[model samples]
Target chain A: MPRLTARERREGYQREYAFQQRHGKPFFPHVVFHDTIVSLIVVALIMGLSVLWYVQFGAIPTDPMAERTGGLLGPAYEAKADPGVLGYHPQPDWYFFFLFELLRIFKTPQLLIVGTIIIPTIWMVLLIGWPFIDRNPDRRLSRRPIALAIGVMVPIVLLTLTFYGSKVPAEGGAASTEPGAAAFAAGACSTCHVLANAGTAGNVGPVLDEAKPDYATALALITNGQGAMPSFKATYTEDEISCLAGYVATWSAAVGTTPGPGAATAKDYPASCEKAGGLFAGTVSSASGP
Target chain B: MSTLLPPPKEIAMMPVDWVEERSGAISFGKFMLFRNVPKDISWLQTLGSALITVFILQATTGIILAMYYQPTPDTAWMTIQWITNEATLGWLVRGMHKWGSSVMVVLLFLHMGRTFLFGAYKYPREMTWITGAIIFILVMGMSFTGYLLVFDERAYWATIVGVNINGTAPILGPALSYVLMVGPEIGTNTLSRFYSLHMLVLPSAIGGLIFLHMLLVVRLGVTSPPWSRMEPTEGDV
Candidate 1:
């Protein structure tokens, strides 16, 4: 596209303005009515889908009391101890999934600022500064290949990242072999304690590898709790607690090497954990012992 | 010039008539509403108007939501829950506001695209485009900050990530992050700061900027299609 000279651009704007003065429509009813109709349609669509889809609001807000009577959002949202996919790993809304995926892709701590901040900030600046930089007078998209390419690539990259991010687990580890993994997932320990075997990367508490508590210590902590880690005794059965403590003790020691226990045995605990139970139920052999 | 008002039958008449006579409100309204927009400006140009419409809808619904939403860390989520589940027609309003934001963002981008494609921001209208850019950033800011007001785990984590992203800027990154987050972390203070920005600062800035944008639109007149070289002759309609 040939750049317009200053005089040519000025004259062009003047001629356009003069033409508009002679033939332009009024803003009152014509433009106003057109905009209103379109906006009304949009509003109607929003309300219609809201009623039809009926989005599920998760558990109530996490509060101080939530610790005692389960979490504020309830146990439903808690990380599944059983584990096929750890669904309770907190993710941003869908719009932010692209960034979330970006964070995942740039996994190194050094690159955190680049993925999370620098790149996005640069994009925003470029977007706001686009008109200033691009002075081409051509009005057609075909003539502006560079601009068009950037526009198309942006959304495509975002969507691709978002799609990948949505399904990808936050942490890495082999599938849980021990039934204690089920108990761990069921008890919501995965939310706070990072355990590789269980595929949990919670940072709120000490990493299980670093603080490899024995069966007795795990059991004590699970029953009584300490610091920010609330006691799960009220929420779990003693059998379930034993399973979780044993699972953590074993897996915490064997951080990376082998997935301990070839498979789990099916022993019905009183508490039914849909998430954790689903994970262990399939993997269980008939060998039942801690 | 002859006076347009007809002789009134009664001296004390409608209140509107009294105001119109004293303040020339009718004339001002005419001047404001009857402004010309280029006939050649296609449906693409209407995106700006559509964006404004959705923005108004967002502001209205947001005002209603603010009536019930408590901006505390503890009660914020519970209040949102109440508003969503129990409040009369609250779900509809909240949904509209949410959807309206998406629509508004889409329209803003489309509108900016149209202006750029037509080269409307070339010379005299640069300020208009600049103000528009600022407004776009403000709108996105409002949306991001508003997302956290939901106080859900998703919202909380989103805010944490968002604030941290602010901290990723170069020299002023940490300070900017601190100011926005109201300390070094995302907490109740950060929530309140976001709430104030969403409800007050950004909206007010947008409102004033939009006024400037519209004034420029009215003053400079909407640009005709880039290809429209046909001029108005003496007998042209």
Candidate 2:
């Protein structure tokens, strides 16, 4: 082999070093630079859109008290403030709403992790790093089965989860007088219980709203265990049994509306106890579960 | 001129076993030094290696982080705080997991893209590609489910979206959902079900699919360099 001069050797080293830096994908490929620029532009556009909404449409001030704080900078702060805005009802934006919906649906505190960190973490890894992890040279749609499957399945799953989230009622936000009642309606009381807005049409047990039984009658059925309505005396209390019986009876007709000669005051619950001849009406709603 | 090349070694050759050569010596040094290489490898092969290394990182950090995390609503956010503040290097572990997931998804997609553009999905590699796709879907499912575990406001609301979607099937929507949540409330049953699906079912499915995907990859042989394909040999293989 021809012997290389010292200069030639140094030149070779420089060339090799440059090659190592670039990894042979064609030097400064325009696609790389172009992709980077496009990404940046998109990000900037989003920011610009937000800023435009704030500046041109005029920002809704966040705090009115800043002007009265006794400082020169206070007015500027107050100018940027739109006081008494509870911040749009404490919700995330559309992009993150699916997750937010998930949290709402996940009523039980114990299963929070499934939807929170674990699933999101998996999605990020799979979506961002899939190409790196599944580096194959196949180009055909049929041959690259994993890619095709993933391509389709991911959207399906995300869409499905999103659907579920949308349907689930928000938790703890709008004051659920009794959320578990919905759960009971889901299946437990489906065959035997009857709630109208619940859309339940069970024919087995006496209609909940129609019962309109007083606290005494309710206590007797719930505690002593009426026919078809099993005795919940063990699982319930004189008070709870009384409440549950009242719950069913109220749904039938307003509770304590005794059509008999001896009835409690309709004078107290004018709005609540209104049953001249009507039964209780189930007030528990199914429209609150996420 | 027709001497027949000495009858091609007629010493009772015993029909040599093809498997014998594969049983050669193996050691860490050999792999690192490329001692057993067929001398035809190139930079394109590095993608496979990178995938494996990153997967190991994901699994290791994921397990470690999970040990301290509390999945329940009452403690989920609080537990994350502890991981960040109380546990030694817990933030790093959690961050790695978080970042690692993003990185993995990006890489996996790229890998799939590479395979597609290169036409590596031809012939014997079809199953491999399919398996990879399944794994990718699983990855997404895991991600969506995980968001709920944080027990934050967003997660709470998002699950409603999840259920409604599940309830979309033709006849079984409502009933299916009722069974899925195990009593229609966000109670213990729902949490346990989701947790089991996330930790056990999904991971295990992913693990199995990964193995099959890799096996198919190795069996099919790394797609030859693009240049090599252009310069077709007489034997084709």
Candidate 3:
């Protein structure tokens, strides 16, 4: 070959290098010097944030596993009042949401596992095995039917499941006691809210110790309104309000009188929390009856 | 086959519009170069690289701090303070790790989106795409478990949210979360659980996925130029 100008020689070198890179001649995107720098920056940043959240706002949950055994949401033990990530439950961050929402669609509260585990596993399998199944060499997005469907479906399905998960109410099974009775009162309601266990005597709520204020007087306070106490008029039906008051007034008569966190010492509040029915036992039964 | 590598230079004299592309047939220069590589790759394309950088930083800082950090509430905050106030480069390492996580999450997200929009997940490279997705998920899980290890308010609440949601899990949820987090309350067990997960489980998954993702990417070749398939708009004039 005849000698070429320096410029031509340089161009040829550059072109050759470029061609080699494209043909997979040992050129790796990740092995570059800058890649090392970039990787350092990224890994450092993520790890740093985690540590910051760890050091500054990580959570040491008062209830790590969900053992709110009794009523009253458990005693809160040693709650650390930091701005930890645990409290703000948008979810397992973004990646898991699509799957989080999936279990929710199943309906049963206990079925959340299907959302977190099974669905995600299935999704992973589908995603990983997708290439083997879809052998088309076409890169056009619109033409790759299987790929297109998967691309759309995985997120859509995952997202749908997450939306469903979000909608699910926080699971709670403490169960409202008393069919027609003010079981809360019988459930040691007087200790906290004050509705007359054995003549309610606590400042937690407007004291109901005074009386056996007949149905009408009690109705105004319990149904319409009371201090620091929102009215139950709307939340409870006329019958419920009446029955609640009577249940409160007589629970002390049947049980006794005591302050408590859950069921007011059982003795202080007649009937076990689980047995207290919600509806009225009899219309003409107690004087607090509506 | 023979290329001389020049020392790093601050080429201010050359035209500002062009990237610094030297050609002296240097040995290392040749190894570092791309032959026929697409020209469009830019700073934006370096997001994955950036993420990997931050992730490694996180791991380094985290391991160092893990040496001194205590999980108990009474000792947790104090230990952290001790690390920051007493330990060596504790503050910088911790701070970098903290900021590093945020950067990683953002870069990974950006990287994933780029992959999706560029049709980088096509036939031969689908595994790479999938591995990237798994890395994204693992990053989140790492964030989650790691947060609990920190044992702060946000972490506490986040833990509650975790537990509450986990409690919603089917069958053995209440029991499972109990076992995972080590009981119904934040105690020694909770810290241990978080610590193990943060240091071990999450990292392992992330490591494996990253390996596979990188392998596939190298094998498939960074996507080429669309313009290559067509005639050059201006042939060397």
Candidate 4:
């Protein structure tokens, strides 16, 4: 169909105005009534959620670690912010799950901007500029196939991203009794690399489960650093590095399976743990009991 | 020719008439209340008003929260704990604010989707859509800034990542990151910065844009559902 001229569009709108003036209902009783019902529903829903969240929160736990373990709506609050500890996984609220998932897709340093800023910015620009871009005067859904398809596609894509984002494993590792495991969790390793044994799922560096680096490779990389991965040499002692490297080598390939090629065995962990001699030793002694 | 004492109804309406006479508010109120909307408008059209309602709830609850919320690192968490565990109905206020934010976002997207699918953004309503779009971005900004106000572990780390994401945006990335973080780290300044933005800056901007958006809506009038069979013909009247 030929595009409507500016004059035609204006006239069309004028006719619409006339028709509405003649046949439409008053905003006071008609539109206001619908709006009032919706507004009331929204208020009730918010209040209901608040009450549900409050009632579901069982008594606050005595254990600081378990404090505010919220109910269905989620906890009233989580553990206090401790910047010194970097082991915690960062998750945004549910609304941001789509962007959070975007970070996972564009995990590489080179493309991080694409996910973080570029894509979202472009989406915003497109959204704001849509009216100008789609100059077609047709408002009928059946008549505007492109608009209809786009309208459907955008929500589907966003919902898919949000679903995946919500499913992304928490990057924070579980508490481990093993000396090497403790060291790996305490150090900056959990912030970048995903190691299943440590329960970390950081996307900034290689997923150790997939990489399965041997002791020597893990040690060298940890000491020397690589692109986007910082060197730990300045921060960690040689022995501490060995303990971390051993931990990675032992667990990166997965548990209970023989590590591939030159990987450190579980037996090597005690020696590295002894040499590291701080948090590692503390964990070792605690694990051994008295 | 009127009697010394006005009729009882006029006496009762005296104050209202005086104010209306001075400000023309009564006429404007009448215009707003009595205006005609397209006959085919549906329940989906109420989403916009619903969004405004949620925002008003957020603002109210947020004010209640800010009364008790401490912005400093040392006391922020403690205050949050106090509000949730100690203050009467504090949990309810905070919970509503927390949950209300997500609701507002959901309603925002739904309203935007309705406008898009209905082709309500076309023609004279273009400005309305643009203003609404800006309001959408501002609402997201409000969300990002508000997340850190809780000052919990998750809030802190998420904000760290959030600021770092801002730092990834080419030439202005570092500057943006610096402004948000106020330094190399997320410290006292960062929390206060987020607090200011969340309550003061972003909310005001969104409120202003929403006013413009509503003005456009009232001016252009609501659209007829695109699928309605009652499409107005030019010569039908």
The DockQ figures for the candidates are: 0.35, 0.04, 0.18, 0.58
Judging by lDDT against the true structure, name the best candidate: 4
Task: List interface RMSDs for the candidates, in order.
Answer: 5.9, 14.2, 9.4, 2.9
Instruction: For candidate 3, write residues B1-237 as lDDT tens digits.
Output: 124643335345343314334544354455445533344455556777676666666788888888898877667755755564457767666666655665677677578656654566754566687788778777877877766665544456446555645555457766866776686556677887778888889898898888787666655556643223422333322
Name the better of 1 and 4 by DockQ. Answer: 4
Stretches of candidate 1 exceeding 4 Å from the true structure = A1-3, A53-87, A165-290, B1-6, B9-24, B184-186, B231-235
Best by DockQ: 4
Worst 10 residues of 1 chain A by lDDT: A75-84
Please state the Cα-based DockQ of model 3 relative to the true two-chain complex.
Answer: 0.18
lDDT of 1 at A213: 71
Displacement of the residue B232 alpha carbon in candidate 4, Å: 8.8
TM, every model: 0.71, 0.43, 0.52, 0.84
Cα deviation of A130, candidate 4, in Å: 1.2
Residue runs of model 2 more than 4 Å from their true location after superposition: A1-290, B1-48, B225-227, B230-237
Best by TM-score: 4
Candidate 3 scores a C-alpha RMSD against the true structure in Å of 15.4
lDDT of 2 at B74: 59
* Chain B structural similarity (TM-score) per candidate: 0.89, 0.74, 0.78, 0.95
Per-residue error (Å), model 4, residue A163: 0.8
